[model samples]
Target: MRFNRGRRSFLLGTAATFVADFVLLVPGLLSGRSVRAAGQPVSADSTVITVDSTVIDVSQGAASGALALVTGTTFNTSGTPEQGVRVRALDPATRNEFARVFSDANGQYSLNLDPGIYEIRANKSGWGAISIAVTAGAGATHIVDFGNGAPPPPPQEGTGLVTGTTFNASGTPEQGVRVRALDPATRNEFARVFSDANGQYSLDLDPGIYEIRANKSGWGATSLGVTVVAGATHTVDFGSGTAPPPPPPQETALLTGTTFNASGALEEAVRVRALDPATRDEFARVFSDANGQYSLDLDPGTYTIRANKPGWGAISMAVTVVAGEIRILDISP
Candidate 1:
């Protein structure tokens, strides 16, 4: 209180030094608002997403009670929001996650980002990845509705169509020609058709190697290899042009079997026929000869032998007949 001039000057000088030090460090210790790179205070903004002129009903992952707009999805997760399932602004060019958001239990997320394409990935535990594209613009409210799964993709064009006709080697429309398409390398048939009255056959097939075979009774079968390209027309013509007839006494699967009783006595006057399992259709039938031997002609197919007599029990078994091969179905009671 009674300091001299020199003492008073020292006290004033010390106070000035302390004040200067405090001012220098005040900027660091004080809590200040977030600043932009240009030193401007950051301001809060609302995120908005617009629904485009797309068919929203069938949009990807659109289902019950779900509303879907561009800003991702607004949904109800019940109780609490699933973590990691947040709203984020992605870099349109590189498609990298840039911004993030968390949805409340009512599934509300906001991404106040600039105008660009952003990806919205959900944190749906135990579920597959769910994502959507959002076009965020200034002064827009993006309310995307997400359900438990992904949205359905847009509709596509009709499946490829295959069209054509089957003609006999004589260049005439032969009705009842069963045409089949087989994969060239696998030889597995996937499509079948019948020639119309005009000997026309058509099919829509995926692009692949295929074999078109024209099958008819009495006449030899005709086949041609074809490669179907996508969106390209494949015309197959099995011109009946000058095809010779099968040689006389055309070879067929001729099966011969003897029928007899368990007592070793030959049974005669027996009615026998080959049965097809797939179609349940019966083929040719022949009676037993005097020696109890029976013969029948059939195409290469798995067949069953059925026998009937006035007093004897019927006998039958399955027989697999390969093309140009003979198979015997012995009769047993």
Candidate 2:
């Protein structure tokens, strides 16, 4: 699928806030000291320094120089710092990634870059990704953060939850399948998501009748209708129990013959052409060898076979070939 610049920007904005409550940025020059948020429990893998309240001062780090500094923290919906999220800096025009780093045990990362416009992305397996656009100037510092908040909360008043698993025809869980909620009356899609590794997906929607559809490439889609109620949960599953049959193998046929003159003498170096009679489009061409023998391999079809020589004139005949056939015809031209 392809998206224009405007559409790409819209999608990035929507996904950034999809589940995350909000992104926080504390941009300023901090003392070289790294400080953690008071009373926050430290994970076993956490580093000694954590930046929760202020941005890290690049001037004190190895990146100190004329290069611009980009820094941020990764956190969960509840504002708890998350470790090991991968952050990337990409060229805005070409969308080519130039730099990447993983959040430290303190859920913090810093990147130094040349002055330019960039698309910053944060991602991790199993969790959705978020991205933001930024402009970095020489000798400047910018802060950006990312996270898709926790799972959807219980349906509030006037809203309900839908959850399900997508399966293949053979009854095995199918990951990466797209699941969508559509308005029953208008048939317009309202929300969509890709199933996770375990084939699980969920959507929070307003109370109404909806068509829940599951789709994946190479497989027929499945859908179900449900009447949603406020503050309730619904479960739905998709797929047929039987598997689809395998595709047929491809096969070819061969056409071989000898060329002869009108006087019944074997003629060598005669040009043999095979063409589609209806369109007169040539498919194969070859010259008779010293022994007056030539061959053409083609798919099953009807073709116009023509043999010609400078002084021997030409002969045209309609020949039919079927799969696995080795047809032989003598041409006297």
CA lDDT of every candidate:
0.44, 0.57
RMSD of each: 27.8, 21.6
lDDT winner: 2
After superposition of all CA atoms, the RMSD between model 1 and the true structure is: 27.8
lDDT of 2: 0.57
Q: Write the per-residue lDDT of candidate 2 for residues 133-169, one digit (tens) a residue.
A: 5556677676665553334234434567776666775
Model 2 superposed RMSD (Cα)? 21.6
What TM-score would every model get versus the actual structure?
0.25, 0.35
Candidate 1 positional error at 328, Å: 43
Which residues of candidate 2, in runs, are more than 4 Å off? 1-153, 240-333
